[model samples]
Every structure is written in structure tokens, then in C-alpha cells.
Target: MEPKREFFPKVKKTVMPRPYFATEKDVLGHRGTAAAVDAAIYGSNWYLDKEQGLIEIYDAGAAISFFNLLPRKDKYEKEGLYLRLKIAYRTTENANVNLRNFSGNHVTLPNSLTGAMYDDPQTYWWVTDDLTLNINSIFSGEKLWIQRVDWEWMSKEIIYEDELFAKNTILYRSLEEVQKLYSEKELTDDDVKDFLRDKIKNDDWFAKKCLVMLREEQLMGEKLVKLFEDSGLEL
Candidate 1:
């Protein structure tokens, strides 16, 4: 006997109505999990575009972190400019964090002098729970825009070191410090440690790679902010 084909509804493009930010109250109303969201959304993809504007949610993070990390400059703060965030969404249980490129339409900045990314309504995600996610680039300027946010990310140093050293750590070498065994030859751990130390020290290329990783992490942070905003609560 042949099985019947299941019918599925066509996916539609979501439209964000009057409110752009989501508060914790919305989540309480909808009964959602913040942990799952933090893990899946912000912990994943985020980044910037080549055109000097933020791409998806992740891109927004990268841009903000980049701006924040740069030396204080006058023009970036004084210039009259605004950011347009293009948000896409889905309500299905199978829905994942997938922030696409900006729609090219920018959200106007609040009337004020010395604009900061974190100050813009478009860049912030406020939830009914009173939890707000602020996105800001550490640096400023159109020419230096392409530099990835991960380079300036503070947490990257520890996170990367932990992941890279996970298997070779002292804790994993046997909880007992079994080096007491006479049969064991010279420790091979020194070589691995030395190699990693040198890579972080002498190799300029390794430094660049670290920068990319930091920017990617920043991107993830932005996505989480977007998810909270899209949750449909007051921001």
C-alpha cells in the first residue's frame, strides 16, 4: 500500500508591525525559553556586510563591537546617520535563527546629537521582562568598517584558549598527576603548550585568525538580540 503525501503550508515573509523591540512580557505571554534562545540564536551566526552597513543581526554585533574597539574619533560620533535593520522571522517550532541581509531600508535615528549605535531604537532589543539587549560597535568610520568585530571581542581570549586546550589540559592528564610512574617517558604536553604559546606570540597570522573568531562571536550576540526583539513584546 502507498502512503499519502503530507500537505505543508508555504512559508511566508514576516512583517514586523508597529513595535520593533520585544520585552519579557511578550515571552511570558507566549511562554518561551530564554536559555534555548540564547544558545541557539546569539550563540550562532552574526556579521557585517561589505557596504559599510550591518548585514543581518549578527553583522550588527560585529559592526558595533568594531566601532567600540576603535580609538575615539570625532566624525563618527558627530555625523548625522541612522541604521536600518531588516528583520526576518518564523513561528514554527522548527524555526531556527536565520537573520538574512538588510532590506536596505534604514530605521531613522532618534533626534539627537552624537549618535551612538546603542542609543538607536533600531539597534536595541527591549523586552517586556525589562531585559534589553544593546548592540554597539566599538569603533567608527566607513573605511574601517569591514574589519570583523571578533578581533576586538574581549571574551574571545579565554573562550578560544579553553576550546583549543580542552583535550590537552592538566585536568585531563589524569586527576592524580600520574607522572609518578617511572615507566612514563618525558612529557609530550610541553611540546603542545609550547606550540600554542608560540602561535599566539610570534605568529602574526594567528593573531588575525583570533580577530576573526572574536568578530564571529560578536555576530552571534546580535542574533540573540534580534530574536528577543522579534518575540513580539514591548521593547
Candidate 2:
């Protein structure tokens, strides 16, 4: 006999809107003194080359501040937001830069000479806060040059399989089946607990199946697992 294949709901993804850019005018201030460098050499200082659109740093413990750059909290309270930096920089030695919000939540930028975009691994919780970019140079002569900064919302909707199932026709049938099972008796707290336990178990099973199907696509699968864990569903 042939084995029956499991069918799962089709996952839907709505692409997020384009990212918003922050211009040089948005820069508010700096923590350390900005000095001019006549030669290619640098010291324990920072330089803002407005003409070249770069914020150059030569040592640790220096920061560049920017105005609060995100929308109101209510705007993305449910979906969450992200901060990203578009930097074209080179370092004499290994360096790290921290992108921090007013609330002090931050993400680090590891050493990279090639120009590329870097996203904050943490979600932007405080949408209405100023931002800062702190530089950390590993060596005395290490240098860094920051080119640009931008931010955006999460790229896709975060929905769990159980949440989707709750809106499906199968959920209605399941509820009706439970109702029929208790038709003759008044539902009690114990009965409700039992029902919820069964429902959760069923939802967990469905989520696991969905995860298995998504496993090959690692990013999607990891996202699904995070959603499942957040929703209190077992893997």
C-alpha cells in the first residue's frame, strides 16, 4: 500500500516596503573631536569628510550621533522594524562598529573592507529614538570610514501555522466536533483545560509538519520556528 502524503497550507509572504534613507543632514553630533587629516595617517580621533560623505575614525571610543530616525512606535508595534547601515569602509586592522539607538539597544558591524549593507540583528523596539554609531578600533593605527545609513521593516509577515489554522475551515469543524462531544454536559473549567490541551497538541503536530516541509529552506524554517516558539507552540 502507498503511504498518504501530508498536505499543508500554502505559506504566503508579503514583501515589505522599501527602506528609508537618512541623509547627512540627519547627523546630530559627535562624541569625540573632529579633526583634519592632511596626510593618509590618522591618530586617536575622528574626521567627518562631508565632501566625500564619510565619517572616518582612527581609534576606539568615538561615536557619531544622528537624529531619531524611525516612525512612531504605534506604526510598527506589531510588525517590528529594523535599522541598517550602508557603509563603504576600510580598516588598517580588525575593527568593530556599534549601531545603537537612544534606548541603548545596539548591533555590531564586524570588520569588512568591501562596501556592503549591514542590518541590525536585533529588532528595533524603540522606533522614536535617536541613533549612534560608535567605533572600536583594535589597533593604535586602525581606521574606519562610514558611508551611509538606512532602515526598514521586517521583510515578511510573521505568522505561525497555528494562527493560520485558526482562520481555516478545519478549525470550525474541530470546534464543532468538540461541541458535539460535550453536548449533554455543561462545560466546566476542567473540560475547557482538556480541550485546550488537545487543541495545543494538535496545533503542535501541524506546526512540526509544516516545519519539516520548510526545513530545506533554512531561513524560512528558522523564522517559522521562532514564530512557533513565540506563540507558545511546541516544535
Candidate 3:
């Protein structure tokens, strides 16, 4: 008798919708047992008020902390896996900190007391490696009270909206310059194609913009599409 083989495989992914908070004990207790800890000072500059649920930083120059994101290969492989940090408290006057990762990808936290999201263009973590995240204060006066850290997979609609905004910004700037140059003469189809060709050839970021223009059926959109297709450029 032959062994039975299943036609389909069942696979599920676990996602965390709410923010994950790490306490003082959690960090201090699991410091050496887990991955390597570069620097985590408790009393000198970094203080944790368990009562108020806040991690306070005072005049600490680049105070660092490590976080271990449990193995989640499926979640990491998905698109728009944005890392978010909930800033509970921050000084109103020039108080901010930089959230740096193991890969050196960092984003400046907003001065205001709000949640900061990391829009990293590069891959943050790998499937086989331990996901270690770090945080630091750049300036001496920069004080921050971090509440918790979390991550979420952004929806496709939100991603599309951001792309739309970028496309519109580029289109507006290009049109402003074109209008000034062709104020006296009527803008012809050839003029539009030439402008687009120059943008596509010179600007590296214009390829995305060209796709947006074609989707919106803007002027010379067809011609621009044809030009890219003829040149064997994948848009």
C-alpha cells in the first residue's frame, strides 16, 4: 500500500494588532540569557518607573536597549511591516530621540507626544536571525518617555494613497516649470513627450511617476508608455 499524501497544506500566521510593552524587569532579567546586550544602563541615565509605565531618559547620550521579536517568518515576509513606537511623554521644547535598529536604519521621533512609525525602505529583519531593535538619544537635552513598541502590516489602500501623494507632488512641480517655459507658445504633443522623455531619462524616481501618469490617463501618457516599452525598460 502507498502512503497517503495530502493535496493541501494548512498554514497560519500570527499577527499582533496591539502594542507590546516590555517592563524593566523583563529587560534586566533577560539581558544576558538572550542575545548580546550592547548597552543598557538602568540608573545613570535610563530610568524606568514601573508605577507610571514609562521608560525615562535624562541627559543620556545614546542610551540603548535591546528587544527580541520572537520568530515570525511569515509576518516578516509580508509587505508594509512597519515598526511603531508609542511615545508616552516627551518635552515640548526640542526633545526627541532617534530609534536605531541593528542594521543602522533609523528614524527621528517627532517632538510631539504621539506614536512614531518607522518607514524603512530596506529589509529590517531576516527569517533565520533574531530581530534585535535598538533605541538611542542623540542630544544631551533630548528626553523621552517611551510607553511601548509595536508593529503592524499596513493596508494596501494606505500604501496606494502614499504613492498617489508622491505622484501628484512630482506632477505638480513638473507642470509648474513647463508652464513657465511654454507661456508664449501653445503646448504641443511633441513638447509634452520631450519633457517626459527627459524626466524619465535623467530622474531615477520618474519611473514610478510615469506609471502613475499612465494610470490617470494624463497628457502624453500613452506616448510615455510607448517610449518606455520601446526602450525595453520595465516600468
Give stretches of model 2 more than 4 Å off.
1-44, 68-75, 78-89, 96-108, 124-128, 159-235
Poorest stretch of ten by lDDT in candidate 1: 149-158
RMSD (Cα, Å) for all candidates, in order, is 26.4, 23.4, 20.2
User: Which candidate wins on TM-score?
Assistant: 2
Where does model 3 exceed 4 Å of error?
Answer: 1-44, 61-66, 69-89, 101-103, 113-136, 154-159, 162-235
Provide the TM-score for each candidate, comma-separated: 0.15, 0.39, 0.36
Residue-level error in angstroms, candidate 1, position 123? 61
**For candidate 1, lDDT tens digit of each residue in 1-235?**
8899887788688887776443212111111112212211232234334353433332134212212222222212222212222121212222222212222123322221222221223222211121222233221222111222111101111234557656432222352443344245565889889988899899999978888788876767677778578668775
Tell me the spans in candidate 1 whose CA falls farther than 4 Å from its real position. 1-187, 223-235
Residue 167 C-alpha lDDT in model 1: 47
What order do candidates take by TM-score, descending?
A: 2, 3, 1
lDDT of each: 0.32, 0.51, 0.48
